[model samples]
Target: MGGVVIAKFLCMAKARKEYEAIVTCTMGCAFFGAPFKGSEMAKVALLYSSVFGNDAYESLLSFMRTETNDTLDEVVSDFMEIREKLVPKIELFCAYEEVPTDVAYAERMVNSPKMSSLTQHKFFRAGAKKLMEVGFSGLPGTHFVTKESAVLPGTHTIGLTVGHADLIRFESITSEKFVPVKMALTSMVQTARINARKRTSGQNLLSHKFVNQVRRSLEGVDMRQKFRAKVEQRQTTSWLTSEPQYQQWMAIGDSAKPLRSPHMWLKGGPGLGKTNASLAAIHTIGQTQLQEQQTESAGRNETFLAYFLCERSSGYDTAEDVLKNLITQLIDQEESLAQHARWFVPNPGYRGAASDDSLRSDLDTPASGAKATATVDNLWQCLQDMIEDPIVSSIHVIISNFHLLDSGESTTALLVKLREDAFSTVATPRVNHRARWLITSRDDQHIRSHLTAKCIAVIDLENDREYGGKVKIARQKHAKDTVTKLRQTKKYSSDLASYIRNSIESQSEDEKWIDSLCLLLGAMPNNSSSLTIRKWLREMSRYSINRLVDHARDTILSQNEDLTLEIDELLQTLTIAYEPPTLADLAVLTEIEDIQQLTELVRKCSPVLQIGEVSEDRNKVIFGHPEFRDHLITLYHGDSEQRKRYHGSMAWRCFKYIEKSYDRGQNGDAKGMRSLALTERIIDDSNVLVMANEDEEPDDAGPQVKRPLSVARTQSSTSIDILAKDFQMLRVSFSTTTGTSGAEMKAYGANGSEIFRQ
Candidate 1:
């Protein structure tokens, strides 16, 4: 079967374009059951020949013309009619069997009335059933047989009788005569695979790219040489003298001897050059040590160095996992060190042991002192060995993130022990001259408490004058660019900018207005917290500002007349809700009569509302900020009596809106129906309905008026019925009080009466 499929694929590939042309011509005739002309069948045969082999094409053509007794017109017409009826049915069966799988093809068939009905045929039904039985069902819940069609026991006749025979014969002839074509397809697939592999291999890893970019950026400047030259050339007039922070940094190594420390802490905020300084320090130390090692290696033959980042992951945050990663990366980078650190690998046999005995055994093995002792110990022990070595002792170990090293008590204890072990060697006369350690951290206290040695140095980054000035300049530049971009948007600050520019450009002899506007903007407290800004904006509308800051402030504030009452109503409703409400809920509460009006209100209030995107629901709605919601709530809740009176009016307005929506629905407006449904949903929600119940009592009694009893009864009954329906829709329950006794109403039928009350 696979061979046959492959053969067909190869034959299709050979004359794919020609076959497509023939298929296109036959599609309409096949779909309508119309007879094909003699030319049509000849065309199909010609395409088949071009696709398979020339000999087969000619043979089929000759057979069609000479073997059959029927006239070409009759034969061709019969083929078309058979194909017209059969091919569509076959396609319908294929659709039912596989559901097309391709969404585009399925959608086309579904949209076409003829194609949809063909799939409803008995043969297609049976095919679907067979497919389901074979565990190849396309979608669940779709029934194979319906009242209109029953499953029949047979392969799809259209495909088996018409399409299958021709396809099989074509494949058989092609495989027998087209060996070279089959090889070409195989070669093409292999070539694609090779190209894909090459493309993947050529892509650079992010870390390598970062390192190369940074290296290229620093290629010309040698930090150690530069620093030395700067120190040598320094008089009283250099930029270092002007920059206090630069002076402090350079002062650390100003003396003949390098600044000695048991540990170091560099503390600063983001973009303060702490990282750059640390990298430069490491680079200088490494280059100096490597050069010395190379000179000694000419006589002793050995090398030493290692560098690795603590934080690296393809995806997800792994900051806490940096320690283990750093160790693994270091091992991978240095082959000699890796061989010595085999003890770090967990023993396969000891699955869950907590003790380090298995690892200790691997590390404790004895060999020549020069090579065996080269194995890593605690950081301090490694430092001690470096100090002891005659030819290879001048090793400088640099470690960063000293604060992140020991997050827990146990790890902290281990780190303290390692530090103690290293410093113990400092007491030895020879050890002091052989090795050095550089550590960087934000907290000096954390390191100090552990080390207990006054030898460690703590550098406060803020004290660096040059670094501070650079940071200030960077921030100002960033703020300027941010303001520029904001102004360019024409939505945020563009209008304000235009107003400012126009006010200045069109200023009459009165220059006071322009000066006052700038003063007001400057004194506007842009530095105020975001919450303060929102509060200030809400209280200072155009009219309100006109009363406070004269006409200038009023002119700065823009308003649209269309937004007047709608915006006020929306704000009032939001104030009542006391929380950011979803659009559906807000529309209900506000008794918004028109969806378009509600949409416009939301757009107008965008600046004051602080709208946020809906997280779960894709439905159009905006959430106000929590503080803004709180402010509205305060306004609504301040006067309980007035609030109740306001709510009553709102509820009555909602009732009228619902009636209008229903009238619109009766008049055959789908929009009105949707609005009615939404209003009904809101009125039916327990929270809103409960509020309505509270405000149901009339404030003033008047003369009794005759009401339609039947109409009243109908509305009362229908209200309860709608409530019950909504409860069911929302999957909730309601409590009913019957003569001072309450019962839980769980389920209700279409009528107003409860069916399940417990």
Candidate 2:
């Protein structure tokens, strides 16, 4: 109310100064979803959401460092506080409204149409108030101090009911077309009013004109449209692999058990179905929300927001890019918020206020245009503000190919911030009522460490050490499910469907071949898409199923123009990007012309390399799927000379990235030299092992760890002059550090000065 009122006041002030009509009784305010307080439903709803939010936090603590519990504890405490604050506000409003008796409220809620119904709101607000009071006196029926110990499941039916009621309501209506006649009439009435005001009011005195600087200041400003993902085109939710194990994960939002972790990290190797699982889960959320809308429950509304990072695409590599895209998507969902972006927009005219020197100061670049936007500070603030909005019940953000982010201070910091904000909740009665984040990444230790440190829920598809047998069973069932779904598609003829089902059911050995088989099926010829199951079976009858799949894989790798060459390129790139590369960095290396090119390549390399996920335009790439990477490495090592040649190419690229300021260089040169030297060694080493063995140089044997470098300082002019007279060209040597097998590097000049020593 304050923000809207201020904006209107500014408009009114302008109108008074000039004859223009700006502020009106009706402007942007349309619909608002207010959660109820003091009702039975509110108490249950708060508990269920809290439990669901904490589910992953508890489950994944063991996977993380013990110290993370402290961070996780702080987050949970803050969320409860949020609920407490909000419930009271909601109750104060509903107590004055015409709230119905509890029984009538329930019946009224069941029959409400749109989310704006008075009776339905009465129920939600009343429930929220009741829940808030319970928090004050201790859980309404129980006195357990610990959130975990309070409230039994079946004994408290309200938990389930409230869980169903707390979904956030955020819908974009500005995009809808308004009735033309109504709009014309409104415009005419406005014009008539303006004419009357001009005739009856002010004398046209001093010639003074003032443009509403606010509007001009934000000319062409729009953050909502800049970033979006083509998830629908990639393969709607149905394209996802639906296994029983995955089903348990998707059902977490509805479950009463407190989330062991605050968020879920869906871990998997490349191409093993992490994104598909995410998509499937997202689809399920959509369905759940749709059901709520249909029922007019006004209890809960879940809004899904996702950003898939692609390496070959536009701006997905950097920390800043991800933040911008995430914020953009959220704003796009709630069009009313678009106005706030204008408020944040810098007043361009203000630059003229400062002297030329200060205006020219480059230390802090003004984020005034499209190129400079979304600072780290404002990015998180914008998201938090949106999440905390009363109408936005719950925001579920899904980020796929999370490992694609280049390892750096910025990326790490951004991840930490995301983890912290995942716990921000709606105030007073429903704190868990705000947002939760879900990510999919390879099992990279660095990435894992950061998320687990925040006590995030982790569900690794490939990490099956505990229940291998059950996983195998699930895999078999998954394969059957795929076949069943495939049978219904238009591509499968009745005969082929029967034959496929028969072949699948008859196969005695469940070797966990579902994913591979699905990959093979997808990799089949373009003509295969139209091939009836009968024709496919007939073709298969000539050769065994394994042989057929092998042929298909070979065909994809060798004969397919669209896929073969693309896969070859992806294989080579991933092999060289052995360490993760920022999506933008890879794009430059691969010379990717557009996101479609990268998307096409990833599509071609499926079942082998998850390579990366490209967003609508920006691509974020990550190298993973150990098996796929190893296979590529084996091929790369297939010919020793080829491997050496590739290493040489990579070495040259690394050198290009190095800041070649010899005189100004200090410590950073050593780090760059080490990387360059290692690449050189890799090229020089004969018979390079795809998998390191005893024959390999001990220095380059194990996984590498990157240490953040100190800020490089310029050497004194006197030192530079003295060194220049005696110095020769730099010489780099890559060798093992004192205690680790990991290759480290050092650099020297002719004077034998340790120019870069680490």
Candidate 3:
């Protein structure tokens, strides 16, 4: 009788497997054609079990009827028995309850230095022994066990039980509420064991791999803290205006063409706030989703979200890493999705109503001339599964720095495929389909050309009313607020606001200066353009324009001659450079060695020179606005010989400072190095070296040039060496020619190159 019951159970398991195979094959052929056979089999099985009731299969039905006090323990033992006895014969379903606790324990054990050094195979062996001692030591007649659990209590639970038929209940615990906690626990334990084994199995496997994954999981907390800190710091002075352009973007998204395709593009200069606006939109969407979930009391398991910053400079010259990272992020959010999201693999054909042998043969068929077709087919199938899966019903993806995909050569093919796939999958009208795409990039012609063909809506930053229109008004109010706050802190005089106002009003009459400032502002990238305006005032030695105006008003009241001298000196200093100097650099140039005195001077001249935010690293300074640098450069031509003389010493000092501070390994120092280059040219053209080196010239009567022979010789040698090195580094060569037109330089790489005649 026992043998008969066992044989019957085996036969049932075999039949279930066959049914599953048939259903899977049919579904693979026509995914939406018919209901899965497995569902029908489950229904039939449930009905048959209801009628049997311990008559035809007493031993089998008796195990199903028995209930254990500890479901976790029972399920774990049963799952182990199924794994051993059902292999190559039957399929079993199991669940466990204390899975989280088991995983936590395993993680802790693996991280322990004393035990972690052991290989995963050895580690699992040891862990299994430890788990058996702790969880199954006292339990009578228990053979094997596995476990899993509810991540959140009262949500769900599952368990399995297997052993001697008389010792276990197989029928009584079949209610939906009766979770297989032991099976969940066992599964989690086994998962941990398998992970540990993989981590420690071979020379390629390093313990750090597990440690790093754990570390990555903790990164979100760190990122949140850092983001909060940045926001707080910026909030102190940084201001944001109500942007109508953002509303327009929302409108565009709302009115987006109802094709089955997904497309979006935000175009702007660096500082135009495209990224911020996009992020804001995404946040709004997420909040909306949260509200819907709250109102419906439905779980958010069906939603998928991912953001990718393609501007990050990884080694590859393509967006593959960015795409992969985005996918990985999405997968990590829902682990089950990871299995369905296949990459870099070709598809197998539809197995529709095919036998197991036929399906296997089709899958094994070699890819010859149909490689591309096979690949796309596989990808389409995978995508179909992902979209249809109940787990990932809605997906939203945001890719930043879309300009990175504009490279005409390397990324063209991949971008084409991605665009095709994106449009093909989403743009079409499909019931219950939900997906959205957002992309941000500079408004370059290349990007516009590619995206326009695909019918993507492009939002231009320059014309964005939200950011561009309200900037001035917002800045003025922000300035006022700043002054008010400073006064409240007792950090400055109460009259500071009026002083700054008067000073700015006075500058309104300087048309030339204002025009220079405007030009400078126009030159800045969208993101940093506002900073240009601030930089102008800082360079003008006006740390606080309010204070400067106050002092001017006071001077007018007293009729002081010092004001005249100060104004002249300030103008002279300001007009000497095409760019603004840092407070430290200015102090050194003016011989004002005292930091406090320099600060005071800057404050007094704030109307002309705006003081901006200071960098965390005190070695360098930033202007109130990058536009101010443009203004300074536009107003003064340091190139003039006389003007260069006034700035020579200061320029040389700046050059030395930049040389000392620069880190060649990283991106070059933008301000310092560029400023030094300008100054060096000024110093070089001023004839200062020629004059200085004249005394060291040989007494012999040569051409009687101002420059010493040795100095001229050294300069020529240095120039030749520099030219040679530059060519060598660039894998190019240069040749010089002398004709009636004078010296001409021609550069040649492996391919044809350019020529520069000087």
RMSD of candidate 2 to true structure, Å? 24.5
Q: What are the lDDT scores of the predictions, listed in order?
A: 0.35, 0.43, 0.38
Q: Largest TM-score belongs to which candidate?
A: 2
Compute the lDDT for candidate 1.
0.35
Residue-wise C-alpha lDDT for candidate 1, range 287-342, written one tens digit per residue: 55456445512212222333222211110011212222333333232222222233
Candidate 3 Cα outliers beyond 4 Å, as residue runs: 1-261, 281-300, 310-318, 335-390, 401-408, 411-418, 425-427, 430-434, 464-495, 498-758
Candidate 2 regions off by >4 Å? 1-261, 270-273, 288-312, 316-318, 339-364, 367-372, 375-377, 422-433, 453-455, 460-474, 481-758
lDDT, candidate 2, 129-177, per-residue tens:
5544544334333211112222111111111112212211213333222
Q: TM-score of each candidate?
A: 0.26, 0.38, 0.34
Whose lDDT is higher: candidate 2's or candidate 3's? 2
| Worst 10 contiguous positions by lDDT, candidate 2 | 712-721
Better of 2 and 3 by TM-score: 2
Ranking by lDDT: 2, 3, 1
Ranking by TM-score: 2, 3, 1
